[model samples]
Target: MTVRTGDELPPLRIPITRTLIVAGALASRDYQDVHHDAEAAKEKGSPDIFMNILTTNGLVGRYITDHFGPRARLRKVAIRLGAPNYPGDEMVLTGQVTAVAEGTVEVAVTGRNGIGHHVTGKVTAELPTDGPGTGDAPGTGDAPGTGDAPGTGDGPGTGDARKRTTDSPATTDAPMTTPDTPR
Candidate 1:
């Protein structure tokens, strides 16, 4: 079950509650109390506040991985925060593929609140393909499919993307940098 282009993920609607906020924070190792306490969040600079970006993103990743199955390798992920997710607010995560290349499938992901967008996310996965989906055949699923995974060498995503594996799996886009920030 290597995911192919246009592979759709299941819908998720989770209410952003204090417990969730705390759990997300703890799961991501982000100990910022602002995410766990309303008053602390307010003192920091929030009206009602909720989980931090890292926490929100971790949940989103978990959601995708769980849906895509064990063969899924998260190759890329990008997200931007907008409206704050406060307690009692429902956050929905949805996505669809934008492109595929050499074992990689890219998807445009977004997180929205009841009223509007709270965050946007991008992710790519080197998923198991149609044949057995487990890549169970050695030289294929046994490895991360740097293209040599089993018989998928000639599979659908064989392109420049194969070269990207040498540096890192590129789980996220380039970090945002500005001229004003010191290099």
Candidate 2:
């Protein structure tokens, strides 16, 4: 596909349900009580259970792939959490293409909820030169929360979060860098 810097992706609104919060925590294997136990969260100073970083990271990846299509391979994803995503809120994800080079595209993303910005980050993806939807259907590839290569829950109390392919283990130990960094 022909993408350009400054292109904006359509915003995606996601309801923040208790089920979603608990399920995401469970799926990511982030047994952190603050993510699934309201009482525990309150005990820990949180008003209620909150969305974990792994879930937020996955959502950010989904936002990028949803715009660029399934052929888009996520090269790098870096994000930071802001406000907590509690049930009964909604998070609207939006992204802007920050840079495009050769067959790769970079986007700056934000997910906002009633409290404030829930997540802010950047995603780098390699899109197929053949255009959108040119490969396997979405959800057919490595999905977040699954024991897959990419989304292996690198959050608190989890394993490594480095990028990898389904067929092989990750080979890099370097830190996750922005698109400006040399690959």
lDDT of 1 by residue, 1-183 (tens): 434456677778888887888887888888877877778888988876577888777767776666655455665677888888888889988888666565556678888897689888777666554443343234443355554454575443665356554323333332222122244
Model 2 over residues 1-183: C-alpha lDDT tens digits? 346678789999999999999999999999988988889999989999999998888889888877776546787787889999999999999999877765567789999999999999888776654422343345544354433334455332343324332322232322222222343
What are the RMSDs of all candidates, in order? 12.2, 9.2
Poorly placed runs, candidate 1 (over 4 Å): 1-7, 130-183
lDDT of each model, Cα atoms only? 0.66, 0.74
Cα TM-score per model? 0.66, 0.73
C-alpha lDDT (0 to 100) for residue 67 of candidate 2? 74
- Please report, as a residue range, the 10-residue window in candidate 1 with the lowest summed lDDT: 172-181
User: Which ranges of candidate 2 are over 4 A from the true structure?
Assistant: 131-183
Q: Model 2 RMSD to the real structure?
A: 9.2
Q: Between which residue pairs do clashes occur in model 2? A: none
lDDT of 2: 0.74
